[model samples]
Target: MLEPQPTRSEAAARPELTREMLEMVFDHVENGIYLVDGQGVTLAVNRTYEEMSGFTNVQLVGRRLDEMVGPDNLFSGSASLLVLQRKGPVTATYSTSTGRKLLVKGRPIFGDWGEIRYVINTIWDLTVVQYSQKIDADTARSQMLSEEDIITCSEKMMSVVDLALRVAQTDSTLLLSGESGVGKSLLAKLVHRSSERRAKPLMQINCGAIPESLIESELFGYEPGAFTGADRRGKPGLFEMAQGGTVFLDEISELPLHLQSKLLGVIQDRSFMKIGGREPMTVDVRIIAATNRELMDLVRQGRFREDLFYRLNVVPIKLPPLRERRDDIPLLVRYFADKFNRRHRCYKQLSDELVQRLQSLPWQGNIRELENLVERLIVTTAEEIITPADAQLEPQEPELDPDATLGEMMARQERTIILSAWKKHRTTRRIAAALGISQASAARKLKRALESDIGAENQS
Candidate 1:
């Protein structure tokens, strides 16, 4: 026999059930959800948020995010506030006072009149994971072109990636300006993969790497007998070869001034003439240019064409250097270590001391330098655990007093180690983990070390 079902009248009588269901769903969601009004006042926070942040709705529901974020408050920063300021979506990563690092993506909801009504912030924990688990080398290499390979936890780099992904759908020319080894080429590949012309080819040419004499022929293929060494049969240039695709012009600022005008013509008319050819050949291709030097500076110096600069600068994306995004160093270290370990068919893990030491370096060569260092360490280190001593980095030691007692010398050494760790890993929990101590002990020792340093500085 079929069980009796509730009638419309019976269901309507218990309207509270609908509200209860919504509340249950909100609380049970996996990711933390934070809702804020346009005025920046916290509207609601789900149970997930409370669990993740260790703050209840009663404390956050009526509070302003700005008031809650500070050195002495619940958060160090708020992405929802950034969205309200920019009137757009924002993705940011920040550490909480609770020692939890979080990645928050805040999206604004616009009202009928185009004003922002609310901002919804979705949060994800970015805490570093243990490196004991091994990754498959083949699987890691296979994701090189995919989004997963671009490992970054820094907010600045996140914003850059966000902008790149957003602009990938359009056909506008892009100018990627950044220091070398900042992953400009990788980003260009990402843009191509994410574009409408993903099925089409992505032709790459380094303007600086090629000899100036043959650059014209390489970019715009010569007609038969156009030049002494020209092929008998005319060939298609990059613009033609990359038909319905993208042409990544690496180190574009190095292109000779004479070629800039021709490049501009291709940008303006979507056509270019082959060497020794009278008629222009039409082509459909997107242009993505990268440069390490400042194009504007070169323009003022008359080295680069202003018109061409403006053409390629339609959508400029400047990637921050690795040094500027230091928060990503540990993550990058782990990634490269895993990558090389898989490649070499050996399992190796980086010691906390070495990782902390790496974080303190200037990294003038940026990500390229870090990757090379990690690979070198992985292959060269004899043991399964790679340490700072294995890397042969200069030891950071405190100056000793000739007449000081053994206990005093030991105290000085301890202070030096604790201070150095504090410089690289700011949080007490991280410092404690790096130094193999309890969080409470780390905090107490750090405070005493700081006070002693201050006293010494005063005396000096």
Candidate 2:
């Protein structure tokens, strides 16, 4: 049985919809339409909603919406009310009485005084848009570009993956900053793969890898005689080549400040001309920038532009260092070993002691370093099982900059401790009680921790 719900009269008086309009709305709607008061009480239900629930308006008018969408099944914090507060549209998910899932998009209806009148929401049953999920599945494939992916048991790495996937849908400028070898490029590739632009080619450029003189020309093309050794026929630049696709700017921190303004201009105006071309051309290139450097600090020190930083930092996804995701060492090792084994025509295995040694050692170089170690173990270690002794590669954890803030360091330490605990116990309840938190809260925090941990690696 469901809990008894309060009605609209519990707070304010209810308003009426004209009969003709109400009939038109109820009759023409395919998705179930409903209105709810700020207090969560149901006010009106369209014909579609009535048919789905097998209940008349008289039976449901005064019931709480939560009766149908339990707190657990909801996306939480009513988006309708949020829209009402923000005076904007909001989207959310809800479960229906018929056990079908719904994607509810809503806007807050306001009175003349700008007060929240009621939340008018339409729920398009997920089944109707089921076919569109294939686009989402394809987006997922784009991100798996570096199939040498690791076990993201840590919270940070998981957060990065989820954020990358979620933000990939939107055409937002993204900045991915983390420690080196933390799979920054891999995550960037994933974002490209997960976006609607997956059909478009994903072009990658490393600002640090390219010569300083050629970086600008490479990004913004050159005319036939623009350069001393320009192409015979003017070639399209990366921005042009990546039209309708994504251009991942790796090592973005290395981009010269002189070029930052041009990059920002291109991103903002979505148009640029070749080095000597007079007319500007437009291209739709989603940018995912990655850098292991602290860009904010760089900006403060006058090395990076604040405007460029803001443009790219719309979503800052950080990848966790290997030391933080140590629990995944064996998993990654096995994945890489198997990959190298098939490639090298060798059957190499790791020993239990080697795994323990791996866990004990702090992997400063992160997943990339671990991968190299695995390959080395497979290639050179002659024993049937590769022991830690055969894996001579070791990384000394880098020291953090002295100017790193106390708050930042403490937050990082807290994350490390929490992630290590969750990994060790493998249960949120146990970790929560041990850390003196409510079980429910523990679960949420653990989820976020796992999200953030799996995405970013610590620099030190």
Candidate 3:
């Protein structure tokens, strides 16, 4: 008896063509191609496909797609199942036993009667692409880490760095704004270091950390015996000492309204007078100011001088928060872990689970918090692998009294709820949605929560 007539697809495989012609046509193609029956039983594979799969024709043909996949198989899952599920095209990525990544596209061809006839698959090796991306990322991370110790995989942070470097070319006053602990200070230093004034002194003065009355003396040096407890020799101010260099005024928003006017004059005239000296000592100094608080809000509230804000904000860089750049967390974690390990003379690394857990945290304190946690874990934990359970990580916050007033109770509860929601949803927009409030309100609440004396619980 004559053999059953082959379907159109099956006939096209041969189509009165010689085996040599088919082999030449299939083998000459660069991409891998394989064909299977409707039941996903491998019918044939080209030389490229065999080489890609690391399987010979005898090993693949007549075996079902499911049967071909095993623990030791080149590819893990079956794209055939996807095609079978929808009876249509399916595209997926799979890893080979040799560690190469393959992008496979499977398409089904229907017979004359509309029945499934053949499933043709095309595979492209993505190992080159994967390796290229890994290399580029590594190179960028290395350069950034070396220059500024900033470990970031997110494009947002990279863009910020790019902008900062460009702004560093000249003596333009740069204003960096972001959430607290978001590396504003570090970026300020980066700007200073990248600028042409790197040879000169780079002075950092925290406006908020210093006493209100002494801010003036700290900024502009006083004459000998200018006031009570004055230095007899009289020291030069940061602006005077930072001549031809950068003066980073961190927490600039905390500057008093009166001092803001003095700072504005210095920025405009490039000179500032000593507190008790009659002569105005002229000095060329580059100013790079940073504040976690919104200067606009402060200006509107009359807490920050609008003119000074405009002067300092000549070039603004908004450093992205840790939540917005969660992609960098792993890199940061590994860096900090290695850092503290070496510093503490202990070798400790975060387990995969612990890393994932840390990545999921709100990180309101941003990079500083992460660094502290890594160091704390390294110094505290004895084990080499720090797991989630082993770390027993809890965010530090100010505690409330059991018999506190209603206002205190409400503040404590509000902080808790806001932080919890913020943790679950990393974005202010999402947090607003979750809490049924405007994005601005959500941001204000988060800021207030973070500032609340919650860490005071430790003191009690």
**Best candidate, lDDT:** 1
lDDT of 1 by residue, 1-460 (tens): 9989999999878757578899999999977999999999999999998888888899999898878865566886677876776676666556667766565778899999989999999876543222222322312311223222455667898889779878988999999988878989878876776677876767778888778886787788778888776667765666666778788899998899999999999999999899999988999999999998889989998999999999999999999999898877877786677668867878899998888889998885689899999999989999999988889887756567899988999988889889998997788976886678999999999999999999999999
What's the TM-score of each model vs. the native?
0.58, 0.55, 0.57
Give the count of colliding residue pairs in each prediction.
Answer: 0, 28, 4
Q: Report the alpha-carbon TM-score of model 1 versus the true structure.
A: 0.58
The TM-score of candidate 3 is 0.57
**lDDT by residue (tens digit), candidate 3, 129-160:** 11111212211211111122444546688678
User: Candidate 3: which stretches are off by over 4 Å?
Assistant: 1-148, 393-460
After superposition on all C-alphas, the RMSD of every candidate to the true structure, in Å, is 18.7, 18.3, 16.6
Model 1: CA > 4 A from native: 1-148, 395-460
lDDT, candidates in the order shown: 0.81, 0.70, 0.76
**In candidate 1, where is summed lDDT lowest over 10 consecutive residues?**
138-147
Candidate 1, clashing residue pairs?
A: none
- Candidate 2 to native Cα RMSD, angstroms: 18.3
Q: Candidate 2, residues 206-278: lDDT per residue as tens digits?
A: 8887888878877887778876777766666777767787888988988999899999889899988789888
Q: Assess candidate 2 and give its TM-score to the true structure.
A: 0.55
Give the Cα RMSD of candidate 1.
18.7
